[model samples]
Target chain A: MQLTDYEKQMLGGENGPAVARAMDLLVRYGEALGAERLVETRNVAGAFNASTPSIRSMAEDGFDRVYSELNLDSDDVVDIPHMAVPTCQLITGIDIENHALQGADPGLVDMQKDGERFFGQRGINMMCTCTPYQVGNVPVRGEHLAWMESSAVIYANSVLGARTNVEGKESTGAAGLTGRIPYWGLHLPENRLADRLIDVQVPVEDMAGWGVLGYFTGLQVEEAQPALNGISATPTLWELKHFGAAAASSGGVEIYHIPGVTPEAPTLEAAFGGNPMPDPIVFGERERVATWERLQSAEDRSVDFIMLGCPHNSIEQMSRVAELLEGRKVHADVALWVHTPRALAEVSKRSGYTDIIREAGGVVMSDTCPAISRRLPKGVRVIATDSAKQAHYLPAIAGVDGWFGSLEHCIDAAITGKWRGGP
Target chain B: MPDGQSTSKIVMRGRGVVPGKARAEALVTRQTISGWGGINEREGSVIELRHELRGQSFAGKVLVFPGAKGSSGWSAYFHMCRLNGTAPAAMIFTRMTTKMALGAVVTRVPAITDLDGDPFEMIETGDLVEVDADEGIVTITKHET
Candidate 1:
């Protein structure tokens, strides 16, 4: 990899040991990925540290060792005093506030608290959300960033028009220290061009429909950049969130283009970057329904848990849930947990959405989801969720039967403790 | 080391991203492994309930799969596997993506990818495999029953 003079200096330890080590790792990582050069990341949109048992086990070895081993892949411990740019934590192993609710032991919770404090003291924002953009870490169009979360990576590249690859924890951590990343993959302009075209034949009128469309599209164009056409209406931010999250989960889609909807693709021709568009892969009602059915594994109608907010709920989504739960009560046998960002939870509290859901026998939590927490109550054999991403992961992670449905359908399931299975 | 006939070796070549060597039984999965909490770090087993290899342990075997899936935290979990001494001896990926590449690096396992043909088509579970990643060769030794 070709390194600039500044990068060379950093590699030579002119800046500091930590920065030098980070630069060295980035250069090697870039070379391993066939990158020709490194690029300057204008701002660190967010940095998600990996919370694993190995990481927690390294607590005795101290934070520097944990960062070195997990993030830098080195044994030489170095202090990361501060990130060069603004950064935020992603969903950690345990919900710091509701550890008992997630069935976490006291030791695990204390370790999580230590991890939180380590990053917090280093000037990293301890938001602990997958949806950082919703919580004051928004990166604008054309900005270069090193982001680690898959959903956030897809959303940044596809919807926000910002450039980022699906960075691993190591790469993102290195970028946080050095404020740069290798210029390769999705970061390149030519690589961002859409190679596949998708025609939406079904009416994608809501967030669930958008998720289904994204899920199908991801399977159709695995690891390829896709441009969508034939959608008549403009999609909201929440819709795009679901779409990007599902696409990233179902497929290895790092970036996508929607000609009229997204920022980069102002026109079809522009989306293709002067190249000829491939034949459109038609996504109709058949594909949509098939994808929805594939996500549902629950044969029984009874549901023990209804979980929402896989990608972390935005304020609008929270408001909608509150509106749906008004004057209703969750089933006595069911537990409904709504997850959002900490900042958004505070906003919802001020707006009374949190209280409304709590009054209805549902709990609104923050900073973690089922996939990250990897725990559920002992009797949670059957679960229902509105998010396609959650539906895809919960079964694999928690070993629970899942029912995928629209937000309204999920709310109805929460109310009656049964999944009738419809929007 | 078996008392059967001479070991029959079928050698295949690929790009070696990490340089090392290992010999172990193969644990093959056509589906990609989700990174975060996809495997139980302490046990080194596939805990993803929907995965074909769910509940099966990948510890000390050559983990063969299509590639990585899910969060960028994928490498982190695999790294934990290494720290816990429960990671696979080596890995063979049909397609190399950022998540898996980083994972291969962090785990420091003898890893190879971009094979001449599909590794899944040829490799199977219980096959005795030898990976010479430094030489970019994967030798599958089929032990006759």
Candidate 2:
């Protein structure tokens, strides 16, 4: 891999020991990916908190030890420095406001608080949500970014027309300190072209339809980029967010194109970028029903828990949830949690949506979700969610059955404590 | 019945990823593994529901698989596996991705990929294997039936 003089200087420890270690990890990671060079990136989002139980013992020593071993992949502990580029924190394992409801230990909450203070002082913005683009870090088209979170990576690459592969925690850590990442995968212009094509037979309407279509796309495309055709409706940020998140969860899908819907492809002819588009795989009603059925892991009708957001809801989605629960009371057996970003959570509270939902026996959560934290209401045996990503993961992660449906079905389940959803 | 199986030795060549050497029993799976919610690093076990390797521990064994899937938390979770002393003895995979490469780098285990022969066909669970990632070579000793 080629390195500039400035990079060489950083590797030589001219900036500091932590920067040197960060550069070394970048080199090692870059070489492993067959990356020919390092790309400069001022936009970075990474997973850097000492939130989980696995990091509990490491936190006892110092945050530096945790950063040295976990972030830099280095054995030596070095004095950390301020980030050389713009960086923000992603979703962590614990929600500070609802840790008790999440069954999280108080000590772990303190550990995460200490971690925030330590990294926050060094200029790492605590955005603390997966949807950084939804907040304020929207990168321009063709811009290079080093970001973690598979859902956000797919969104940036596909919807925003920005370029980034699915970077990991360690690589993002190095990029935060040195403003560099491996120039491979989606960074190159030629690699972003779509090769797999799928024709949508049914109306890809609403978040639920987009979620099912996204799930099917992941299974078919796997790691490859896909192009969608035969769309009848234009999707907003909500549908696309759920679509990307669902695709990333079922398989390792980084980027996909919807031809007219996505930014890069204005037409079907332009989507392939001169690459040969494969024979169209029809995603008819049969496929949609099968996809929806696969997401349903629950056999029983009783739903004790209802989780509304996976990629974290937008303000509109929060309002929609509030509007649905305005006159109803949550069933005595059901516990409901609606998640949004902290920045948006404030708006939800101020907008009266939070109070309405809370009065109806639902909690508005921020900063984390159940799947990420591996926590739920005590003894949750059956779960229902409107998110395809969350429904696919919560059952597997929490050892409980799950039901996937529309937002109305999820709200009905929360109010009646019954599973009324079907394919 | 235990004596009825063939004990054949097979040798294959691939690219060295992590640059080290390790020898251990091979635990093979064709399914791609996820790191975040799909695994329990503290216990070194696959926890993803409906995964074929669910409840199986890769600790002190050669983990042969397709590659990584799901979250960008792949490397961090595998890195925690190394710190907890629950990582696989060696990593021999078939596919390459940013997630797989950085994961192997941070796990700091002997890793090899892109072999000339199909690793899934030639390797199976409980097979004694040697991974010399520095030289990009793997030797498999088939186990008893």
Candidate 3:
């Protein structure tokens, strides 16, 4: 890999120890990917998922230390969130909140606190939550990038067509400091192509259906991008969020083209950029049903837990849920949770969605999800949700009788405290 | 470079991410790792829940998978693996998740995505394999005593 003069000077400690240290980390990152050289990143997006006290303390301390050591400019504002959110549920252990706050096994609260400290010192704008794209930081196509999530990476690559390597937490910190990344993969046009093809002939109407289809297509496509055709439904930006999230979770897709949506391809041939699709797969009812089955547990019984917001709930999502539960109440036996960033939580509070959801017997929490905090009420024998991505992972995270259905089914379970299958 | 090994064998057909070449042992995962707590940046080991390959090192292996499971943090976990010297030699996405793709790109490990067969069915833990991310081809050579 070639290094520029500035890079060499930084690596050689000609730029001082702090720049050298920061460059040194980036250089390792560059070498790991065999990047020929590093390119400067612009409009960089920062994200971190530290959920342990010790690690969080280190991260928080490191951010401050690195900032002061380098004397970074304030204009290089960071986009880190003030707290952490649960990314998964605990399979073992008791007392969800207690486990997250004061467990023998390091808890997530400390991680949140430490992250807050680090970004706080730098005056980094920390918008805690995985789905930063939905919040206005959405990068335009062909933008150089850095982010710290699988779904976001996939979304950035596939949905947004922005170039970013699925960077780690420290990578974001280093990139944030140095403002550089090894340009390759998704950044390159050659890497984003329709290596495979899918003819979507199903009637995918809602987010749930989109989630199921995405999971199915990802399962079928696995590691390749597919040029989709015959998509009867023109998914809204909101629906595409679920599709992109599920697609990335089910497979590793850097880019995908919906006939009318996205830029690279206006037509199937254009999506492939004139390249022939070697294999064309058809997705229909059976495929969707199979994917639904794979994402859900076969068990049929009363459900005790229901969760939403895998990518962190947006204010609009909260408002929608609020509308859904205006006159309803969550099941007495079921515990429902909605994950969001504290910043958005404040907005939800002012918007009255918080009160409505809370009145409906669900808690609107921040800095954690059932997955990351390992905080799910004990003995949740059955769990149901509207997210296919969440349903797919919940079994491994928490041993609940899990089921994946529409929002109605999830809300119904929340209302009746029983497992109800969807049609 | 091993004797009697074919370099262009099709391992599995899932999604494809990076375009390069790498060879090493295969790390198979059933429950994908979470990006947040799934990887220890300092240690570079899989630290997520119920993962069959949990606590296992990712040093120079032809990592195989159905795909990443949770959190946008998935890409970061793999990125940490590269930074801390525990990176996989090559990665085969049995399926591609956005995080996995970004992780592959950030780590710059030779990653071959979009396999021709089910990697989970064909490749098992401890299998010797070679991946060509450029051609989207993965070759597995059965190790003989």
Best by DockQ: 2
**TM-score, cand. 3 vs. native:** 0.74
After superposition on all C-alphas, the RMSD of every candidate to the true structure, in Å, is: 2.4, 1.8, 7.7
lDDT of 1 by residue, A1-423 (tens): 898898899899888888888887887677667678988885553444434454566777778877777777776988776887776677766777777888887876777787778888887888788988888778888889888888989998988889998887788778888888988888878889999999888789998888888888777887788999987889998899999888887887889999888888899899999898788898877788888888787899999999999889999999999999998999999999999998899999999999999999998888788877777766899999989889888887777899998999999999998898763
User: What is the C-alpha lDDT profile of model 2 across B1-145, one tens digit per residue?
Assistant: 2587656889999999899999999999999999988898889999988799999999999999999999899998899899889999999998899999999999999999999999999999999999999999999998866
Each prediction's whole-model lDDT (CA): 0.84, 0.92, 0.65
Local error of candidate 1 at A214, Å? 1.7
Instruction: State residue A264's C-alpha deviation in candidate 3, in Å.
Output: 2.0
**Tens digit of per-residue lDDT, candidate 2, span A307-330:** 998899999999999999998899
Native interface contact recovery, model 2: 0.89
Error of 3 at A122 (Å): 1.4
Best by lDDT: 2
- For this target, which candidate reaches the highest TM-score against the unseen true structure? 2
Report model 2's TM-score to 2 decimal places. 0.98
Clashing pairs in 1: A396-B49
Instruction: For all candidates in order, state the fraction of native interface contacts they contain.
Output: 0.69, 0.89, 0.27
Candidate 3 achieves a global lDDT of 0.65
